[model samples]
Target: MQRLAGNLRTIDPEASESLRIVSYFDVLISRGASVDALLRGAAVMASAVVGATVRGRTIRRDADGRTPREETPTTSSRIDGGEWTAWIERPGVPAPLDDVILERLALGIALIESRRRLPGGVEVIIDAGMGEAERVAVLARMRIDPGALVRVIASPAGALSGADDAVILPTRRALVRVRLDRELVPPQKPGPWGLGTVVRADRAPESLETALIALRLTDERDRVVDASELGSFLLLARAFDPDHPPADVVALSALDERSRHVLRALAEAESMRSASAALGMHHSSVQARHEALTQTLGYDPRTPLGRARYVAAALLMRLAES
Candidate 1:
């Protein structure tokens, strides 16, 4: 566990003690711990947390603050998107806590987050320890299709509570996600003040951070904003320096409302056609406007880094005014 934690810390300096405890489970499970052993071990672990709030969405830890299978819902799931949750039964042997005590079976806490509420099912966890056949067998019992799962933490971890693309499920506690949708997108609603970003799922952590950063910058309460679509203010924000006037932002300030609309559309959508659809304008006009905006800004919003800089500038512009 110490060696693994060291390696994990080398990857991300901020990896917490909680992450380490979970990593220990991940490591042991990976070491060929049997399904029965995994099940028994988790039940025994739960006995150690007796009377702790390790029971719900709260972070689970012992009195000494030792973190165990710590799972936060959005803290684990609501990352950059694409997760399907099942409301199912506990993933272990069906002995209730009382039943376990009556039967003299030590009920341990499995590493699943005690707090992530999967409203319809008893909470369960699938240890990363299980083999492909074992995993398939377990999922079959749970009535989940094996083909639909996505591995979380497949991408590198990002900042913000050490957010990664790890799936937070009841029994399928393995770092795998069930694809509810192809795109792990947040709710998409466009507004003059909204923001959105087009990100690779493999880069979910940073993508989540990018969206969250834009969310922090904007003040829109009713609309679900994506960072990419927040318009000139978000663009100007990237270029704005505290000690200097945002000289680059001046380029966008002179643009007409229709042009701004085109840029915002361009920021949110993939291409000229999509931008036109978003703006409810003619594609030729949108293409023309996008080209003009590219020339005017001295960069294309169609590229990833370019779009990021554009949104950054836009966010700073909002900050300057607010």
Candidate 2:
């Protein structure tokens, strides 16, 4: 294909380059290249900066395969692929093959995205809507033992660094990663991540649900939430109504961002001095703030019962926001 493209470039550059574009993307799709690889390939092929937003995750690469500094493109050609988009950045006039490259890139991305969401694919394997028989069939196709243990990790779209062998599915709300329980490792990056309970391969749907719930419960202090550790708190999270939140949740929502931060610190800290240290405020200041919070929240958050109520309200507040 490269020889054909090089030879035909002498006679018809545009036609030859269009053929190259098609052939290049064909190889990528055949090999099941990742979205980042596709972007890099397009950038190198066009000898310009290429970018894409796939399922709300944005990525870019320059011709040298490094992320380009953020700047406005002087000239560009963009193509929309429903939930995604692809584009090339060039200076002055657009490259002759820019349009073809984007079209192929977009098409390749759509195919890969669709393939990952199809039946017997990553998405379906963790889809709670799928029946047990269907999930079992998917597990069989993926060569995973039905009784083998697995866990799901859920995070904001594009948050997790996926392993080559891991099954990653991008949903509307979160990125889902399914890995064998034994292979599970700490997340490679900082995240408000959710770790689901370990369960059989055929029961991944349940894991996904808890993973998402755990994700919703995460805050700045608690970046990773483990569903298995939540105990009865998970039940409370499910029973809480977003439309009609409890009085504490309402009070929490009414507070300013700074006040909310102080409240969270106080609720999670063991003592007033600890909360003050966490907030980087003097003990006197934290004590004064705590007194004001007690008046505002109608409870002393330092007490055990008050801490539980505050924590529950804070978690439920996140669910309401989600």
Candidate 3:
């Protein structure tokens, strides 16, 4: 390696690295290396060629190749330490979507999330600005032609989630978000994705909040619901910020777990016996707990009004933690 570097001191660095790797492969093959060895070596050599071509880089090598490495951005003129020539990004990488021109053709839900553990995979923001034709053009740039999606899925710098069945509506700011996969739903229209609360493509802000609420409440059910279908849960989610939960919500921490479980279980279950069965408790004990909790909460959590509040509080608790 040192001899190759010394000999190629004044050569075009990219060409020099390419020639060096070719020579290295030739040497390995002549020494009776296997096809697998050449295959792996060729892959590494290609990356090294790209690095050297783009950045005039010299890699730090081991007996094998391509060790764990990170390059620090610097402007110093001296080679003070080890080789730090690896380039972090390629030169020809393109942005996902420039600015979309949208159309008002159709609107629906696309539940999106990241395909990997990383964030910033996809981003889309919708307002009254752009039209559907422009949105389709933008999605075309992304190499996705979802047949009927009014918008586009522009995954810029890998910023948007790539799961084909899910759409991540931006619930917070641009970057920080969550990923939850569901195999149970069909894909909606393909387009750029953004996060908001209630998941929909319409103009209602409350719908975005409702989507967030539904996401928080989502379990193993085959169907993921819409904010519009959630009735008053949408209203509650719109009004309720997790940071400052309502007075009754704060009071919940003071209540015993059994009573709290009873309240929540009864709130969701159709009957006391069913609620008790779900909770793994006897029907009689659940009845007692229910009456006690009903008095403590001022309204029975099982009642219409109280059920709404309880569900909202539960969602808020989850939101705050998340």
lDDT of each residue in 87-159, candidate 3, tens digit only: 2222243112100000000001001111111221112223112234433444445454424223222122234
lDDT of 2 by residue, 1-322 (tens): 8888989999998899799779867766665555765776788788788888776667777654456677645747988888888888887888778888888888888887787555445555665544577678878888888898888887774564455444443322333444434356757678878898888888886787678788877877789988999889878875665668999999989999999989989988888899989999999999999999999999988898999899888888987785
> TM-scores, in order shown?
0.29, 0.57, 0.41
User: What TM-score does model 1 achieve against the real structure?
Assistant: 0.29
Model 1: runs farther than 4 Å from truth?
A: 1-216, 221-243
Against the reference, the lDDT scores of all candidates come to: 0.41, 0.75, 0.40
The per-prediction tally of clashing pairs is: 40, 0, 40
lDDT per residue for candidate 1 within 216-268, as digits (tens), equals: 45455423355555555544444444345455566666677777667877987
Model 1 per-residue lDDT at 261: 62
Which 10-residue window of candidate 3 scores lowest in summed lDDT?
98-107
lDDT of residue 38 for candidate 3: 29
TM-score of 3: 0.41
Candidate ranking (TM-score, best to worst)? 2, 3, 1
**Candidate 1, which ten residues in sequence have the lowest lDDT sum?**
76-85
